[model samples]
Target: MPDSGEVQAVKASNPGDSQVRVYAVAPRENADPDEIVDGFLEAMTSDDPGFATARKYLTRKAVRAWKPEESISVLTNAPDRDQADRPADESKGRTYPLSGRQIATVDASHAYQPNAPGEYNQSIHVVQQPSADGKSKEWRIDSLPKGLVLGEADFLRNYRSVNKYYFASGENWVVADPVYIRQRQDPVTRMDPVAQTVKALLEGPTGWLDPAVDSRFPSGTQLAPGVTTLVTDDQSTLKVPLNAKADRVSAVACKGMAAQLLFTLGDLTSVRVEQVEIQGSKGDRLCLLGKAQARDEYAPVRNAGHSENPYFVDEHGKLMTLSVGGRQPDRPTEVPGPFGKGVVPLKAVAVDREESHAAGVVQEGRELRVGSITADEELPPAVVTSSGVRPADRLSAPSWDGRGDLWVADRNPVKPRLWMVPGGQGERIEVSTPWLRDGARVESLRVSADGVRIALLVTKDHHTTLQIGRVERTFTDDGQTVAVTDLENAAPRLSSVTSVSWAGPSRLVVVGTEAGGVQQVRYVQTDGSTSATSVLPGLNGVDAVAAPYGEQAPVVADSGNDGIVRLVPGANWQPVVKSGGSPVYPG
Candidate 1:
């Protein structure tokens, strides 16, 4: 409360009195009751910003007045030059503990002075305040653990969370973040205040005491959640999840999905993902097409599949397939296929556009030959509007589950056997399907919505068989799969299946071949119930089969085509794609 004039007067008359004993702040008699001042002193132990220099000097309570430029930072204005040498234990006054308590009324009279706009010091006039009990005083500054320093910055550079400044003799004390900045950037300064201030103080101490110098250090530890990483120029950054336990480590980039790592290990570094399968969010299934040795790391998913219409299945279980390779796929887009007179070719229907399906007709287009219905016309459909299970495109046509979107698979128009569904658009996941490059005949296909699970049926040489596949993926990227089983024991039946539709999940309609002289229609249910009805003389129904193996040859097995012609014998025979008429097994 001393005015500027008084302060000047006191300073002029006491050239030698401008010094005070930092240790004399022990006990004082009740010489002037109303003139007493007292408060607490916080003792900090960590190098955190808030407590950077607080523990170096005899720090005063929050209410204590402080002056950083004093002879001793903890001591205020001055008493007498002689007091500088007094022993700290001289019993100069009564003291009390104020470390973890709230205290008030710590006054500065030659003993303490204001150092800055918002700070305090230890060389303060202390007076004990009444405790809540109102009997004896409890909060006091004398009871603090002795030998602790109340620090002050010699030259604070910036008031950053971590006090980056010079102290003691101009050495540096950069109170840095222990857990946070540890993985961030290396500290530019040290935390030993006295040692930090020595160099600067010895040079020109006034520069160390400039008002513009900041004194705040990094104030926190792993105290809260935040993104504390140093982003690099080469598309690299430390992605640390705040809530993560103290020691978990992980590395990820635009390369692919997030990968797990050694927990006890320190900060994360980039890693190459061996393989990975991605699950689409909600109802969308993921499809990563083509073997992209490095395509999994694409930033926005690279869709390089040619215009062969990919079967698309929306979230609502709708299926659609389109024709792709019209010309070079860039010119006028088209759904291409062989469409000629006297040609009973397999037709492609957009499983997605059920309403627009060409019910019964044969037309020739510049790109694709929109095919016609089987001339039998006697085949009554359960749902005519949904159209037949013909793939309209050449893109890898994976079998449909009626739910998930398109999964990357193999598409051979020359050996079009199985049917497939389409895919929808959105924040989609990608799963690249692994097909055996054995070149074997693929008979059928199935996939999980996650795009990581698959089932394939293939034929080896002349043997009929089934193969299964499962894909495994973790984090944001790694994925791979293995075939589970290959069954070659099943016998050949009549005509190929009219359809392979899944019903009530985990179950499908095993539509048997159509019935003729030797071909017969058959249907098998998951409950072990099967039915067969002969609608034709020798042309029995046929079931489409899927074969697995990239190196194996394509097989066109079919139910026998032993039907009769009432009129013309040559034109009476029906052509069923590449599926030949094999003898229909009665078993």
Candidate 2:
């Protein structure tokens, strides 16, 4: 061991130079009108606190009236700058046009929609103004669009998503209420992200998600007064202190309150809250146990189930499963059923959540049939519905809801409608889709896991689009099944959708070509408020896609050349079966 003085001398000789260098760039100080426009646009990407630096390039009047959070345009690439009109005098005001293909647009509620083609361009008007120093005239933006524009990559980098927990219809389980958050909203230092997530949870669900989900917090419940930060005790336990209002609820409701916080905080990658201790404003612990607890302690009430793996029909029209990690016995093994034997080629197929039953459309695209996967003998599939319409306007692939109901679209031009086969056994029941516009046909539809929502791919005026709506089940006075109401087009901007599937509790994975011509797999929140980054870079002829419920479950798709492609972690798309089409996961 070296002496204190020797250690100091050694430290001096071998300095630990692992210091981080933060190069702070000063805001642009140019006075040229063109330069001012450029600087203003550049500063928008900075995400500066309140956009302080970007305001420097704006006139006082314009800055006061502008609202940055009004909207955001996600462009395919950087804006193309052009001089709209040249002023005769260099010092006079002029306008510059910045145009780009917008892939998506986000509203104030953070809901993302695809912007209509040719409607995403921006026009900036810059004028001469007296500088703050009062020494010289400078060019500053006087009038501009209401929203900010950024490249897709930059937009994804600055925004993130966190799901707030809410009670489902029965309150027997909890569902996720996804909401967008700035990437930096959660602090990195002294601020606890787990605490911040809880605060967001206390705010309740967003407008769109509220009607579909419910909260368990008491009417006036809130965080403890005068406490803005979340405190954690030793052993990584989270101490959540609630107001006096929380005490008004029953013991069961209090447990639900604890569950909501635990699920929301656990979802954050930045924080690992193993145990949560719920306390009252007076520091008295609430609910049963009155001690720190783990997520497993509350798993009985969470939506902890996931969907079964995906199954697909091979090029030869044999139903098979891709052996992932030996989850399935035979690699690309033909399923044990009539459809699996290749007697009747299938166009599209869907399996029930229990994996015991399946529904499919025959190759002719006119007949929809249902069969059992657990049947040992080669039994004939029962035909549920058959359409006499043209192939292009005939029956689409089948979808299974959580209730084991089979849903399919009958796009007969003269009588376009949606039909459901109760448990794949009873007669076909025609469901009313009144919200579908005139001449718009349902190309495809998939029901969410909870069976409360449905995503429809509608084709109107030759444009294929995706929409979502509430699934209102109506019954006769005697409790007999009647008409099913579809509140369609929940995600209006997911245009030209080729295929889609529920990828999470409240999120859907959509594959489509945006207005900008970028075709890839993207995730959209069920509320239609935000569109996340593409799940996979791009695939050739992604005719169909399917995903299970969990976060890390394998996503399979039917594509050309590569046949069946599976999305593995880190890797984008890898061939699974080598040749298959129309993939479907258990609903």
Candidate 3:
């Protein structure tokens, strides 16, 4: 049978906070899904990894917010957050997004396109609506099983512009986002006798669920995220915290190992191990590195052309293409199917390792290099729900100059410098940006194939400026040049601006900073003619083309804050990878 599990959601309280959590949960037996949800939230909010919780259901469309005054792009007469009551002179296309909502569930789901032979497009959706007060919400996650794992997504924001781009840098030149990480999802717990009693009854870590001695709640014990047990007292199973053995494997090190592509293989079912492949570290079979851990799960057959799969192949031939390591890319793996509906390796990378190597470094320091996926393979429902990896960072946002090679901002955290890694194996030249800082951030970028034209986004100039420029270097001089540029007063800008693809040879694809679909088309000849619906907008950011997949134009995309992505049924547009929580399985 395939690896299948169930998810459910319930309502609960977080002591002082009035927010209600609709937790997405899955536990073996005699366990509270709520606790697991709470545990996951705690992990996201905390700095220490070892002492936190383990949650596999990070949603695909990462939740976001657009503060009151921060979302205006063309505010001929925009009002401040403190003074807005629907004034008249505001631009119709310039409305700000609400804040404060997040994913309520990240579970698995499946579908069978009869004649087409394809699994359901199992991506995560952050269902949002107006709260009683009018703040935003990413999603309200709750563990729900099978088809119960579904929700309708409404509204999509495509924040795009033409004049500039913003690109945020990552650690060790591995470009990624730093400042705007969302707060964790755990409800706060107060120290009191009732709460303490419930904590003691959890049967977690070292707690024993002995039938003869245990006097705690049965399977129906209340946990966070609003879940209760359907199988209340079949048999009491002890819930050991994920790191009970140790705080070894986590996202941080996993992210590192993801960049470096290290670790060994093991069964993904149980017995969590430490992932380690240090250059000369001692051998410990029990502990494997994070990326390495993901690599071990990539064993599959003819399942051709999967993009989301993480394939592991070390710099050395120590591991080769179709190797477990290659399958686990910069992102952790996800596997979903009827029976096998749990996290698994990204078989896409497993099948396309050599393709990635042809690009550049898949793992180096805190970065993972990934190439475009063009395979026509069918992925398991289990394999489709990996959402925690957002490529809008420095490592992922290399400029697409209409050619094979790419240019990276190399936003390294430790060393504030940029790098130019070719899409293929060439040389990694460190660009000079002596004035950059850890938080300066690269938002978006684009350069000619030969490294000529350039445009990008980054909060520079004392972290208040968003600039767009052209490249002067030809894969030399560290890719530093912005021939013609412009800057605008910063608003809720993009995470990066690689969305600036080529509309045609003459014109370009410009995205936006927020998740809105307000794109205006200007001419490419510099004559600046306007084309309605025929020409896409140029410039801007993360929310630019909300449901971003590829550069194939004349496609309807559901991007922006509203979390909707759509392409024609079989319109040749690439598919998107959604997050998973608990999916229904006939297994």
Q: Please name the candidate that would achieve the greatest lDDT relative to the true structure.
A: 2
After superposition, the stretches of candidate 3 with alpha carbons farther than 4 Å from their true spots are 1-365, 370-396, 400-403, 433-439, 461-466, 474-499, 513-553, 556-587
- Position 571, candidate 2: lDDT: 66
Models sorted by TM-score, best on top: 2, 3, 1
Prediction 2 global C-alpha lDDT: 0.69
Query: Least accurate stretch of 10 residues (summed lDDT) in model 1?
Result: 174-183
lDDT of each: 0.25, 0.69, 0.27
Q: After superposition, how far is residue 289 of candidate 1 from its true place, in Å?
A: 41
- Who wins the TM-score comparison? 2
TM per model?
0.22, 0.75, 0.28
Per-residue lDDT of 1-587 in model 2, one digit per residue for the tens? 65566323331221112131212233355556777887788777664656777888888999898888777887766577897687798666899988977767677655555544444567888888877798887788889988778766566666666778776655355667666555553221222445556766887876555665678787767778755467556666677888887766777777778777777776677666666667887888776332234233443212334434578887777677655533432377777878788778888888887788778788578878777777755545555555656777788888887666788888888878888777777776777677555898888889876666678888889888777766655556744343435443444554578988988667788888756576777776775544343446678778888877776567888777777778865666777777678888777
Predicted candidate 3 versus true structure: per-residue lDDT over 353-438, tens digit per residue: 22322122232223433333333233322101112234333243333332334445544433334555443334555554534555
User: Lowest-scoring 10 consecutive residues by lDDT in candidate 3?
Assistant: 173-182
Q: How far is candidate 3 from the true structure (C-alpha RMSD, Å)?
A: 27.4
**Model 1: per-residue Cα lDDT at residue 235:** 29
Against the true structure, candidate 1 has what lDDT?
Answer: 0.25
